[model samples]
Target: MVRRGVLGYVLVLVGGLVVSVLPASSAVASLPLVADLRSSTGGRMLGLAVVVVGLGLASSAWLRLVRAAGDLGVREDDRTALVHRATAAWTLPLLLAPPLFSRDGWSYAAQGVLTHLGLSPYVWTPSILDGQVVEAVDPMWLATATPYGPLPLVWGSAAAGLTTDPWLLVVAHRLLALVGLALLAWAVPRLSRWSRVDPARASALVLASPLVLAHGVGGVHNDLLMAGLAAVALVVAARHGWLVGALVVGLGVAVKLPAGVAGVGVVLVTLPAAARVSARATRATQVGAVSLLTVVCIGAVSHLGVGWVHALGVPGEVQTPLSVSTQLGRLAHLLTGADLVDAFRTAGSVLLVVVAVTVGLRSRSGDRRTALRATAAVALALVVLSPVVHHWYVLWCLPFLAAVELPARGWQALLHASWLGGLVAPLDSSLRGADAVIAVGVAVVAATALVQAVGHRRAEIRAEVRAGAQARTGDASPTSPISR
Candidate 1:
């Protein structure tokens, strides 16, 4: 145990050190940690190399936690605390440094600046902060209004109120992410109980994930807070009744629209056990009340009024190749010589609704497990089918996925591979677009293939064990031999 802890700590600290030494993301004009490290030809390559090595170390630490977790349903000392410590150690360095690998953090700061100035973040672009704030924001988002929900905008405004220093505003966002991590740490144990998974392993998977650390805390994305709230809501609904669940999930929705799925799941899982007409009527009424209450409350608190409704669709306007919908749109455009982004996005939204309906319909009466799994499915499907797939978006699904058991090893590895690839994708752009796509593609393929191979081996071992047990039973007792 001591050895494992030491190794994890070492790997995490090394990764943190690497992050400290590397330059800030190329997208931002200036970063506190990289002020001295100007963008030179060789310096850029060295920075990329450092990123690769640091991420590798981080991955190793995560794998070690997984292996050490073993098959125990409950661990002896509850190493999740250790994992959290490691996460903190890993996060501290990045928090002090500029946002690594993405300029979205800068946009977040710029939005906060606008909010502090008593401006509607949903209405105004970062252009209003025309001097340093505009320079801090990526040009792509400079002219575009913020797509974030009202709660985050409020929090950002509060952070910006602390100091006019753009860097300090960024730090405030990171601190908010740390608070989210705290919420996650509290929720993971309860979720493991609900899902019947090992508490330690689930905590490690959700809390200590490289994607969570790198994109979540390091990028200072508000998705972390949304997901943490969603997880807490799921657990509360499982332990308490749907009313409490609805309220908490509504709070999450106030933070981000994506979290609305939690509210939907809460309602689905509250279906009555008897399946009687009366029972169904009662359940439907309760759900409707919860839903209405959530909507009214959320609308009331939305300082930006209904303008955020328009801003909600802003992400769809940007066609990054990362999204499956955008990928299909590109393919369709290539084939038909017309832009199909809107059509593809519409299809994606339809598919998301279908997934929700399917989950709701298939949920067995009085089965919390089925409902929770459906919730997880909805969360994952939302990100997968969305028109804009940021790496941080994947964080929306991790807690839910951690709560449930993945059906197959290959599928589990595939999920990890997806997020792992997401973590590395930004590094490619940071490398001045020098073969990042191909490199990430090759890394993903190789990692998934390796996982598949290991999964097959585990399957064979289980098969042999079952076969041996059956053969031993036949040899020991009345294996009624062929009478003929």
Candidate 2:
């Protein structure tokens, strides 16, 4: 455990260092202090190589420590929890350091400010800001607002009403993330208990995860808020044996449209039963009741009750490489000399829905918790594979992955590493003129290393499962315990 803690901290410390030095974003008020630093360096290139290398090394070390400690006995569980918490402590500062941490967040704030001014957000775009009172408009918005769900717009606009300072919005967004963090503190232990996973083990895994800490806590991504609601819904559905799982999912939708990814699973879980017949019936009933609740709630919050649908159409302009449509856009630019990232994203999202539905219905081959986890994994994979994968999308799977009885340790490691790397991905984009290099070298390279961690865990879990099965069958002598 001591070794694991030392190794993990060393790595995380390195990663944090890398994160800290990366260039600030466009939103930061350019202070002469940085110019002084640049002048000291003779305006030469900053320690780009060192920053990237440090984060890389730290990320790898942290990944290894998580795997090594996960393999320990009862003591390993306690150690894992401790190390995870320590790692999570890095979240706040890391987020505070980045310039691009709140690109979309600012858009939400803009909409909020606009709404407070008696203007319908559905009709407002970032382009309208030239004559409007506002914080620094996120140049990243190009000419439009978001393509995200409307609930966030409403809430963000409300928050925006509270301040005209871009810096203040950043602070507000972070504070909002604390609510999601509190929810995690409350739910993770319970979710772990439901899975029969050690509460401490579960807490360490979910509570301390780099993804949950960075994306959910630091970046103030709305995904966390909706994720908390979805988790709450999951727990409530199981506890009450209610057939309104759809409503829980709907609340998530109230936050963001992407949440419907998990909502679909909730519907399956809440199908109603005929005379307490099969689990399907009860789950179905839950779906119906939840769906009704979702519609009513959305209507109450939206401009025209259906205006969000229209606002969704407005975000069709921003071309982003983080999304899958990046590839298609490149192809279009090559062939027709046209930029189509947003259009491609829309089409890609459509196909993703199809794939998600197919997987949810087909993977219908596991236990209750298993089914839920599998559904979440599919959703996450789809999000990752989708064009323009904002880092926070990872928040969708962090909790579910932690709660599930996964088949291998490699899987767990993959989730962790990918999560950590994701938090750092946008840091590159914040760097002027160096984004391409940083994104590819540090961010992408780190992600690949994290994938290896996943492989290690997957291989490890398979061996453990097989050994247990053999022992249960009385087919082998129990001469030794497995070690990784």
Per-residue lDDT tens digits for candidate 2, residues 113-156, read 66666666655666676422333445656355455555665665
lDDT of 1 by residue, 1-484 (tens): 3343334334333333333322233333355434433344344344444455455555555655554443333343556666666666666656665565566777888888888898887788887776555555666678887766667777788887787666677788888788788889888777767667666667777777778877777677788888998888877776788888877776677677788777656765666663554554565467556744665565567455545667787777667767898899889999999989788988998999898776666566566677678878899899999878877787788887777866556335644653375346345333344564335434643564466446544744664465457668774222111000
Please give the TM-score that candidate 2 achieves against the real structure. 0.70
Over 4 Å off, model 1: 1-37, 71-77, 274-302, 422-425, 428-484
- Give the number of the best model, judged by lDDT: 1
TM-score of each: 0.81, 0.70
lDDT of each: 0.66, 0.55
* Model 1: lDDT to the true structure: 0.66
Error of 2 at 9 (Å): 12
Q: What is the lDDT of residue 176 in candidate 1?
A: 77
The clash count of every prediction, one per candidate, is 0, 32
